[model samples]
Target: MSLPVPIDLHVRSYGRVRESDRHAYAQLVLPLDGAVALEIEGRERMLDPLQAAFIAPGATHSQYAEGLNRSFIVDVAPATLDPVVGDRLHERRFAPVGPEARKLVEFMRLLVERGAATPALVAGWAPLLLDTLALDAARPLSRLDALLARVEADPGAPWTAESMARCAGLSPSRLHALFREEHDTTPRAWLLQLRLARVCAWLGAAELPIAELALRAGFSDQSALTRAMRRSLGTTPAEFRRRRRT
Candidate 1:
Protein backbone atom coordinates (compact mmCIF):
# COMPACT_ATOMS: atom_id res chain seq x y z
CA MET A 1 0.00 0.00 0.00
CA SER A 2 1.28 3.43 -1.00
CA LEU A 3 1.51 6.02 1.74
CA PRO A 4 -0.83 8.99 1.42
CA VAL A 5 1.82 11.64 2.16
CA PRO A 6 5.18 10.09 1.70
CA ILE A 7 7.20 13.05 2.92
CA ASP A 8 9.01 13.20 6.26
CA LEU A 9 11.25 15.96 7.61
CA HIS A 10 13.59 15.61 10.57
CA VAL A 11 16.26 17.75 12.25
CA ARG A 12 19.15 15.84 13.73
CA SER A 13 22.05 16.89 15.96
CA TYR A 14 25.55 15.58 16.43
CA GLY A 15 25.43 11.84 16.81
CA ARG A 16 26.49 8.52 15.36
CA VAL A 17 24.32 5.92 13.75
CA ARG A 18 26.33 2.75 13.50
CA GLU A 19 23.66 0.20 12.72
CA SER A 20 23.48 -0.47 9.02
CA ASP A 21 19.98 0.53 8.10
CA ARG A 22 17.93 0.53 4.95
CA HIS A 23 14.51 1.90 4.31
CA ALA A 24 11.75 1.57 1.73
CA TYR A 25 11.83 5.33 1.09
CA ALA A 26 14.77 7.32 -0.28
CA GLN A 27 16.37 9.79 2.11
CA LEU A 28 17.89 13.22 1.53
CA VAL A 29 20.43 14.18 4.19
CA LEU A 30 21.45 17.82 4.31
CA PRO A 31 24.03 19.05 6.81
CA LEU A 32 23.01 22.55 7.82
CA ASP A 33 25.94 23.07 10.18
CA GLY A 34 29.26 21.27 10.71
CA ALA A 35 29.81 18.02 8.79
CA VAL A 36 28.57 14.46 8.39
CA ALA A 37 30.37 11.37 7.20
CA LEU A 38 28.25 8.61 5.73
CA GLU A 39 29.29 5.11 4.83
CA ILE A 40 27.20 3.77 2.00
CA GLU A 41 27.76 0.41 0.44
CA GLY A 42 31.14 0.29 2.18
CA ARG A 43 32.30 3.64 0.74
CA GLU A 44 32.58 6.70 2.94
CA ARG A 45 31.59 10.17 1.72
CA MET A 46 32.03 13.40 3.65
CA LEU A 47 29.16 15.83 3.36
CA ASP A 48 29.86 19.50 4.02
CA PRO A 49 27.24 22.13 4.68
CA LEU A 50 26.82 22.89 0.97
CA GLN A 51 26.24 19.31 -0.07
CA ALA A 52 23.53 16.70 0.49
CA ALA A 53 23.65 12.94 0.31
CA PHE A 54 20.84 10.95 -1.22
CA ILE A 55 20.39 7.42 0.01
CA ALA A 56 18.53 5.15 -2.36
CA PRO A 57 15.82 3.04 -0.80
CA GLY A 58 17.18 -0.17 0.74
CA ALA A 59 20.82 0.95 0.42
CA THR A 60 22.84 -0.02 3.45
CA HIS A 61 24.26 3.07 5.14
CA SER A 62 25.39 4.56 8.45
CA GLN A 63 26.28 8.14 9.38
CA TYR A 64 28.43 10.03 11.91
CA ALA A 65 28.15 13.70 12.70
CA GLU A 66 30.96 15.93 13.92
CA GLY A 67 30.59 18.37 16.78
CA LEU A 68 27.43 20.49 16.98
CA ASN A 69 26.21 19.43 13.54
CA ARG A 70 22.62 20.11 12.58
CA SER A 71 21.09 18.31 9.63
CA PHE A 72 17.79 17.86 7.88
CA ILE A 73 16.63 14.42 6.87
CA VAL A 74 13.89 14.24 4.28
CA ASP A 75 12.34 10.92 3.40
CA VAL A 76 10.57 10.63 0.09
CA ALA A 77 8.65 7.59 -1.07
CA PRO A 78 9.72 6.32 -4.48
CA ALA A 79 6.09 6.17 -5.59
CA THR A 80 5.57 9.81 -4.67
CA LEU A 81 8.69 11.18 -6.38
CA ASP A 82 8.94 12.06 -10.04
CA PRO A 83 10.58 9.27 -12.01
CA VAL A 84 13.42 11.51 -13.17
CA VAL A 85 14.30 12.62 -9.67
CA GLY A 86 13.96 9.11 -8.32
CA ASP A 87 16.26 7.78 -10.99
CA ARG A 88 18.77 10.54 -10.41
CA LEU A 89 18.81 9.81 -6.68
CA HIS A 90 19.53 6.21 -7.45
CA GLU A 91 22.43 7.18 -9.72
CA ARG A 92 24.31 9.82 -7.69
CA ARG A 93 24.79 9.63 -3.97
CA PHE A 94 25.83 13.23 -3.32
CA ALA A 95 25.00 16.63 -4.85
CA PRO A 96 25.60 20.28 -4.12
CA VAL A 97 22.40 21.98 -2.93
CA GLY A 98 23.42 25.48 -4.12
CA PRO A 99 21.36 28.61 -3.33
CA GLU A 100 17.97 27.41 -4.58
CA ALA A 101 18.01 24.27 -2.49
CA ARG A 102 19.10 26.24 0.58
CA LYS A 103 16.12 28.57 0.23
CA LEU A 104 13.70 25.68 -0.10
CA VAL A 105 15.21 23.98 2.93
CA GLU A 106 14.83 27.16 4.92
CA PHE A 107 11.23 27.44 3.85
CA MET A 108 10.58 23.87 4.88
CA ARG A 109 12.18 24.49 8.25
CA LEU A 110 9.90 27.48 8.78
CA LEU A 111 6.81 25.47 7.89
CA VAL A 112 7.74 22.73 10.30
CA GLU A 113 8.42 25.20 13.11
CA ARG A 114 5.10 26.97 12.57
CA GLY A 115 3.08 23.79 12.99
CA ALA A 116 2.13 23.85 9.32
CA ALA A 117 3.24 20.36 8.32
CA THR A 118 0.04 19.35 6.64
CA PRO A 119 -0.17 16.54 4.11
CA ALA A 120 -1.32 19.03 1.49
CA LEU A 121 1.70 21.24 2.14
CA VAL A 122 4.10 18.31 1.90
CA ALA A 123 2.41 17.08 -1.28
CA GLY A 124 2.77 20.50 -2.84
CA TRP A 125 6.42 21.20 -1.98
CA ALA A 126 8.20 17.86 -1.80
CA PRO A 127 8.14 17.33 -5.57
CA LEU A 128 9.54 20.81 -6.20
CA LEU A 129 12.46 20.22 -3.81
CA LEU A 130 13.17 16.83 -5.33
CA ASP A 131 13.05 18.33 -8.82
CA THR A 132 15.60 20.94 -7.74
CA LEU A 133 17.88 18.22 -6.40
CA ALA A 134 17.60 16.38 -9.70
CA LEU A 135 18.33 19.46 -11.76
CA ASP A 136 21.42 20.28 -9.68
CA ALA A 137 22.61 16.73 -10.21
CA ALA A 138 22.05 16.92 -13.96
CA ARG A 139 23.95 20.13 -14.55
CA PRO A 140 27.56 19.68 -15.59
CA LEU A 141 30.03 21.63 -13.47
CA SER A 142 33.45 22.74 -14.67
CA ARG A 143 36.56 22.56 -12.52
CA LEU A 144 36.11 26.27 -11.96
CA ASP A 145 32.59 25.64 -10.68
CA ALA A 146 33.90 23.25 -8.06
CA LEU A 147 36.50 25.77 -6.91
CA LEU A 148 33.92 28.54 -6.88
CA ALA A 149 31.58 26.54 -4.69
CA ARG A 150 34.39 26.06 -2.19
CA VAL A 151 35.17 29.76 -2.25
CA GLU A 152 31.51 30.70 -1.87
CA ALA A 153 31.21 28.37 1.06
CA ASP A 154 33.98 30.26 2.81
CA PRO A 155 34.40 33.66 1.28
CA GLY A 156 36.63 34.73 4.17
CA ALA A 157 39.35 32.35 3.05
CA PRO A 158 42.65 33.79 1.93
CA TRP A 159 42.52 33.24 -1.82
CA THR A 160 45.25 33.93 -4.33
CA ALA A 161 45.48 33.24 -8.06
CA GLU A 162 48.27 30.73 -7.58
CA SER A 163 46.44 29.02 -4.71
CA MET A 164 43.21 28.84 -6.68
CA ALA A 165 45.06 27.49 -9.72
CA ARG A 166 46.57 24.78 -7.54
CA CYS A 167 43.10 23.86 -6.28
CA ALA A 168 41.82 23.59 -9.89
CA GLY A 169 44.87 21.57 -11.04
CA LEU A 170 45.51 24.20 -13.70
CA SER A 171 48.37 26.56 -14.37
CA PRO A 172 47.87 30.14 -13.28
CA SER A 173 47.70 31.30 -16.90
CA ARG A 174 45.22 28.59 -17.80
CA LEU A 175 43.04 29.50 -14.85
CA HIS A 176 43.11 33.12 -15.98
CA ALA A 177 42.08 32.10 -19.48
CA LEU A 178 39.24 29.98 -18.17
CA PHE A 179 37.96 32.75 -15.92
CA ARG A 180 38.12 35.24 -18.75
CA GLU A 181 36.24 32.90 -21.04
CA GLU A 182 33.56 32.10 -18.46
CA HIS A 183 33.17 35.38 -16.54
CA ASP A 184 34.97 38.00 -18.69
CA THR A 185 37.05 38.96 -15.65
CA THR A 186 40.29 38.00 -13.95
CA PRO A 187 40.11 35.66 -10.97
CA ARG A 188 41.09 38.34 -8.47
CA ALA A 189 38.49 40.74 -9.83
CA TRP A 190 35.80 38.10 -9.71
CA LEU A 191 36.69 37.16 -6.16
CA LEU A 192 36.66 40.80 -5.12
CA GLN A 193 33.24 41.29 -6.66
CA LEU A 194 31.92 38.28 -4.86
CA ARG A 195 33.39 39.50 -1.57
CA LEU A 196 31.92 42.95 -2.03
CA ALA A 197 28.49 41.58 -2.73
CA ARG A 198 28.70 39.34 0.31
CA VAL A 199 29.76 42.26 2.49
CA CYS A 200 26.87 44.34 1.25
CA ALA A 201 24.44 41.57 1.99
CA TRP A 202 25.90 41.10 5.46
CA LEU A 203 25.70 44.80 6.16
CA GLY A 204 22.00 44.77 5.48
CA ALA A 205 21.36 41.84 7.78
CA ALA A 206 23.99 41.86 10.57
CA GLU A 207 24.82 44.36 13.26
CA LEU A 208 28.48 43.49 13.52
CA PRO A 209 31.07 46.21 13.86
CA ILE A 210 32.57 47.52 10.64
CA ALA A 211 35.94 45.91 11.32
CA GLU A 212 34.40 42.54 12.07
CA LEU A 213 32.18 42.75 9.05
CA ALA A 214 35.15 43.63 6.86
CA LEU A 215 37.20 40.76 8.20
CA ARG A 216 34.34 38.30 7.79
CA ALA A 217 33.85 39.41 4.20
CA GLY A 218 37.52 38.74 3.29
CA PHE A 219 38.77 42.27 3.52
CA SER A 220 42.00 43.14 5.27
CA ASP A 221 40.39 45.78 7.42
CA GLN A 222 37.54 48.23 7.63
CA SER A 223 39.34 50.69 5.37
CA ALA A 224 39.78 48.07 2.69
CA LEU A 225 36.07 47.22 2.86
CA THR A 226 35.23 50.92 2.69
CA ARG A 227 37.34 51.41 -0.43
CA ALA A 228 35.81 48.43 -2.17
CA MET A 229 32.29 49.50 -1.24
CA ARG A 230 32.96 53.02 -2.44
CA ARG A 231 34.37 51.75 -5.71
CA SER A 232 31.46 49.42 -6.37
CA LEU A 233 28.41 51.05 -4.80
CA GLY A 234 29.66 54.57 -4.05
CA THR A 235 28.47 54.16 -0.46
CA THR A 236 30.00 53.18 2.84
CA PRO A 237 28.88 50.06 4.71
CA ALA A 238 27.24 52.25 7.35
CA GLU A 239 25.24 54.06 4.69
CA PHE A 240 24.29 50.79 3.04
CA ARG A 241 22.96 49.44 6.32
CA ARG A 242 21.05 52.66 6.95
CA ARG A 243 19.41 52.50 3.57
CA ARG A 244 18.44 48.90 4.09
CA ARG A 245 16.78 49.70 7.38
CA THR A 246 14.81 52.57 5.89
Candidate 2:
Protein backbone atom coordinates (compact mmCIF):
# COMPACT_ATOMS: atom_id res chain seq x y z
CA MET A 1 0.00 0.00 0.00
CA SER A 2 1.09 3.55 -0.68
CA LEU A 3 2.02 5.59 2.37
CA PRO A 4 -0.05 8.62 3.22
CA VAL A 5 1.59 12.00 2.96
CA PRO A 6 2.82 13.15 6.36
CA ILE A 7 2.29 16.87 6.74
CA ASP A 8 1.06 18.71 9.81
CA LEU A 9 1.17 22.15 11.43
CA HIS A 10 0.62 22.93 15.07
CA VAL A 11 0.52 26.27 16.88
CA ARG A 12 0.42 26.29 20.65
CA SER A 13 1.65 27.61 23.94
CA TYR A 14 4.46 25.34 24.98
CA GLY A 15 5.80 24.19 28.33
CA ARG A 16 8.84 22.27 29.38
CA VAL A 17 8.92 19.09 27.36
CA ARG A 18 11.66 16.60 28.06
CA GLU A 19 14.05 14.97 25.65
CA SER A 20 12.70 12.21 23.44
CA ASP A 21 13.93 9.59 21.04
CA ARG A 22 14.08 9.95 17.27
CA HIS A 23 10.95 10.22 15.17
CA ALA A 24 10.14 8.76 11.79
CA TYR A 25 9.27 12.13 10.22
CA ALA A 26 11.34 15.29 10.00
CA GLN A 27 10.31 18.16 12.28
CA LEU A 28 10.69 21.93 12.13
CA VAL A 29 10.13 24.05 15.22
CA LEU A 30 9.58 27.80 14.86
CA PRO A 31 8.89 30.02 17.83
CA LEU A 32 6.46 32.79 17.04
CA ASP A 33 6.57 34.71 20.28
CA GLY A 34 8.97 33.07 22.69
CA ALA A 35 11.71 30.43 22.52
CA VAL A 36 12.38 26.72 22.47
CA ALA A 37 15.58 25.00 23.52
CA LEU A 38 16.36 21.97 21.36
CA GLU A 39 19.02 19.28 21.41
CA ILE A 40 19.34 17.46 18.11
CA GLU A 41 22.00 14.86 17.45
CA GLY A 42 23.74 15.85 20.67
CA ARG A 43 24.00 19.54 19.77
CA GLU A 44 21.86 21.99 21.71
CA ARG A 45 20.64 25.39 20.58
CA MET A 46 18.08 27.98 21.54
CA LEU A 47 15.37 28.59 18.98
CA ASP A 48 14.00 32.11 19.20
CA PRO A 49 11.59 34.01 16.98
CA LEU A 50 14.24 34.56 14.33
CA GLN A 51 15.46 30.97 14.27
CA ALA A 52 14.11 27.52 13.44
CA ALA A 53 15.48 24.07 14.11
CA PHE A 54 15.24 21.20 11.64
CA ILE A 55 15.19 17.71 13.11
CA ALA A 56 15.90 15.07 10.55
CA PRO A 57 13.89 11.89 10.39
CA GLY A 58 15.21 9.38 12.88
CA ALA A 59 17.50 11.93 14.51
CA THR A 60 17.89 11.85 18.28
CA HIS A 61 16.60 15.03 19.81
CA SER A 62 14.74 16.63 22.70
CA GLN A 63 13.09 19.99 23.25
CA TYR A 64 11.62 22.18 25.99
CA ALA A 65 9.95 25.54 26.29
CA GLU A 66 9.92 27.72 29.36
CA GLY A 67 6.80 29.53 30.50
CA LEU A 68 4.25 30.30 27.81
CA ASN A 69 6.02 30.10 24.49
CA ARG A 70 3.99 30.43 21.35
CA SER A 71 5.39 28.31 18.56
CA PHE A 72 4.73 26.43 15.35
CA ILE A 73 5.70 22.79 15.00
CA VAL A 74 5.76 21.73 11.38
CA ASP A 75 6.06 18.01 10.66
CA VAL A 76 6.84 16.78 7.19
CA ALA A 77 7.75 13.52 5.53
CA PRO A 78 11.34 13.80 4.35
CA ALA A 79 10.32 12.28 1.04
CA THR A 80 7.71 14.97 0.54
CA LEU A 81 10.13 17.87 0.87
CA ASP A 82 12.07 19.11 -2.12
CA PRO A 83 15.27 17.13 -2.67
CA VAL A 84 17.61 20.06 -2.16
CA VAL A 85 15.70 21.18 0.93
CA GLY A 86 15.64 17.72 2.42
CA ASP A 87 19.34 17.33 1.85
CA ARG A 88 20.14 20.71 3.33
CA LEU A 89 17.94 20.17 6.34
CA HIS A 90 19.58 16.87 7.02
CA GLU A 91 22.94 18.60 6.78
CA ARG A 92 22.23 21.24 9.41
CA ARG A 93 20.21 21.39 12.63
CA PHE A 94 19.33 25.08 12.81
CA ALA A 95 18.75 27.99 10.47
CA PRO A 96 17.49 31.54 10.57
CA VAL A 97 13.89 32.14 9.64
CA GLY A 98 13.81 35.13 7.36
CA PRO A 99 10.82 37.15 6.11
CA GLU A 100 9.76 34.37 3.75
CA ALA A 101 9.57 31.88 6.60
CA ARG A 102 7.63 34.39 8.68
CA LYS A 103 5.21 34.86 5.83
CA LEU A 104 4.62 31.13 5.55
CA VAL A 105 4.20 30.80 9.28
CA GLU A 106 1.61 33.57 9.26
CA PHE A 107 -0.27 31.86 6.44
CA MET A 108 -0.29 28.63 8.40
CA ARG A 109 -1.53 30.50 11.44
CA LEU A 110 -4.39 31.95 9.44
CA LEU A 111 -5.35 28.56 8.08
CA VAL A 112 -5.29 27.06 11.55
CA GLU A 113 -7.39 29.89 12.96
CA ARG A 114 -9.96 29.54 10.21
CA GLY A 115 -10.14 25.73 10.56
CA ALA A 116 -9.44 25.52 6.85
CA ALA A 117 -6.51 23.15 6.81
CA THR A 118 -7.78 20.40 4.61
CA PRO A 119 -5.59 17.42 3.79
CA ALA A 120 -5.09 18.60 0.22
CA LEU A 121 -4.12 22.07 1.34
CA VAL A 122 -1.67 20.72 3.88
CA ALA A 123 -0.02 18.51 1.30
CA GLY A 124 0.31 21.35 -1.19
CA TRP A 125 1.70 23.79 1.32
CA ALA A 126 4.10 21.34 2.88
CA PRO A 127 6.61 21.38 0.03
CA LEU A 128 6.25 25.09 -0.51
CA LEU A 129 6.79 25.82 3.15
CA LEU A 130 9.81 23.59 3.35
CA ASP A 131 11.24 25.16 0.21
CA THR A 132 10.71 28.62 1.65
CA LEU A 133 12.32 27.59 4.91
CA ALA A 134 15.32 26.22 3.08
CA LEU A 135 15.64 29.37 1.03
CA ASP A 136 15.30 31.52 4.09
CA ALA A 137 17.93 29.49 5.93
CA ALA A 138 20.32 30.08 3.07
CA ARG A 139 20.29 33.79 4.01
CA PRO A 140 18.47 35.00 0.98
CA LEU A 141 18.08 38.47 2.42
CA SER A 142 16.50 40.08 -0.64
CA ARG A 143 14.20 39.24 -3.52
CA LEU A 144 17.23 38.74 -5.70
CA ASP A 145 18.72 36.31 -3.21
CA ALA A 146 15.53 34.28 -3.28
CA LEU A 147 15.41 34.29 -7.07
CA LEU A 148 19.02 33.23 -7.35
CA ALA A 149 18.52 30.43 -4.83
CA ARG A 150 15.57 29.06 -6.76
CA VAL A 151 17.54 29.05 -9.97
CA GLU A 152 20.61 27.50 -8.40
CA ALA A 153 18.60 24.78 -6.72
CA ASP A 154 17.04 23.71 -9.97
CA PRO A 155 19.20 24.65 -12.87
CA GLY A 156 17.01 22.47 -15.10
CA ALA A 157 13.97 24.65 -14.52
CA PRO A 158 12.86 27.04 -17.24
CA TRP A 159 13.66 30.46 -15.80
CA THR A 160 12.83 33.97 -16.91
CA ALA A 161 13.05 37.29 -15.11
CA GLU A 162 9.27 37.61 -15.13
CA SER A 163 8.76 34.16 -13.66
CA MET A 164 11.56 34.75 -11.18
CA ALA A 165 9.94 38.04 -10.16
CA ARG A 166 6.68 36.25 -9.55
CA CYS A 167 8.48 33.73 -7.37
CA ALA A 168 10.26 36.50 -5.45
CA GLY A 169 7.01 38.51 -5.08
CA LEU A 170 8.35 41.45 -7.03
CA SER A 171 7.57 43.07 -10.35
CA PRO A 172 9.65 42.10 -13.37
CA SER A 173 10.92 45.64 -13.72
CA ARG A 174 11.96 45.78 -10.12
CA LEU A 175 13.80 42.49 -10.36
CA HIS A 176 15.64 43.71 -13.44
CA ALA A 177 16.58 46.95 -11.74
CA LEU A 178 17.90 45.17 -8.64
CA PHE A 179 19.88 42.71 -10.73
CA ARG A 180 21.52 45.56 -12.60
CA GLU A 181 22.27 47.52 -9.47
CA GLU A 182 23.58 44.67 -7.31
CA HIS A 183 24.93 42.10 -9.76
CA ASP A 184 25.67 44.33 -12.73
CA THR A 185 24.21 41.56 -14.89
CA THR A 186 20.83 40.34 -16.06
CA PRO A 187 18.99 37.48 -14.40
CA ARG A 188 19.38 35.26 -17.44
CA ALA A 189 23.10 35.78 -17.44
CA TRP A 190 23.33 34.75 -13.82
CA LEU A 191 21.24 31.67 -14.52
CA LEU A 192 23.52 30.75 -17.39
CA GLN A 193 26.51 31.01 -15.14
CA LEU A 194 24.86 28.73 -12.59
CA ARG A 195 24.02 26.19 -15.29
CA LEU A 196 27.53 26.25 -16.64
CA ALA A 197 28.89 25.74 -13.17
CA ARG A 198 26.64 22.73 -12.73
CA VAL A 199 27.87 21.31 -16.00
CA CYS A 200 31.49 21.81 -15.06
CA ALA A 201 31.00 20.27 -11.65
CA TRP A 202 29.36 17.18 -13.12
CA LEU A 203 32.02 16.89 -15.80
CA GLY A 204 34.71 16.70 -13.19
CA ALA A 205 32.92 14.36 -10.82
CA ALA A 206 31.18 11.78 -13.00
CA GLU A 207 31.84 9.61 -16.04
CA LEU A 208 28.48 10.34 -17.65
CA PRO A 209 28.21 10.96 -21.38
CA ILE A 210 27.85 14.45 -22.81
CA ALA A 211 24.17 14.05 -23.74
CA GLU A 212 23.27 12.79 -20.29
CA LEU A 213 25.26 15.59 -18.68
CA ALA A 214 23.53 18.12 -20.93
CA LEU A 215 20.06 16.95 -19.93
CA ARG A 216 20.95 16.77 -16.25
CA ALA A 217 22.51 20.23 -16.28
CA GLY A 218 19.36 21.81 -17.86
CA PHE A 219 20.51 22.16 -21.42
CA SER A 220 18.00 21.40 -24.17
CA ASP A 221 20.24 18.79 -25.76
CA GLN A 222 23.80 17.76 -26.36
CA SER A 223 24.23 20.34 -29.09
CA ALA A 224 22.93 23.10 -26.88
CA LEU A 225 25.27 22.05 -24.09
CA THR A 226 28.20 21.98 -26.49
CA ARG A 227 27.35 25.42 -27.80
CA ALA A 228 27.16 26.84 -24.31
CA MET A 229 30.46 25.25 -23.28
CA ARG A 230 32.15 26.52 -26.44
CA ARG A 231 30.81 30.05 -26.09
CA SER A 232 31.50 30.46 -22.39
CA LEU A 233 34.48 28.22 -21.57
CA GLY A 234 36.21 28.02 -24.97
CA THR A 235 36.09 24.21 -24.82
CA THR A 236 33.66 21.39 -25.57
CA PRO A 237 32.25 19.09 -22.91
CA ALA A 238 34.28 16.12 -24.22
CA GLU A 239 37.48 18.12 -24.11
CA PHE A 240 36.74 19.45 -20.65
CA ARG A 241 35.98 15.99 -19.37
CA ARG A 242 39.19 14.65 -20.88
CA ARG A 243 41.26 17.37 -19.29
CA ARG A 244 39.65 16.85 -15.92
CA ARG A 245 40.34 13.12 -16.08
CA THR A 246 43.97 13.69 -16.97
The C-alpha RMSD of each candidate to the native structure, in angstroms, is 5.6, 16.6
CA shift at 149, candidate 1, in angstroms?
3.4
Reference-based TM-score of each model: 0.66, 0.53
Model 1 per-residue lDDT tens digits across residues 124-170: 77788878878878776555766775676677889999999999899
- Pairs that collide, model 1: none
Off by over 4 Å in 2: 1-5, 140-246
State the weakest 10-residue window (summed lDDT) of model 1. 106-115
lDDT score, candidate 2, position 70: 75
Q: Which ten contiguous residues of candidate 2 have the minimum total lDDT?
A: 144-153
lDDT of 1: 0.77
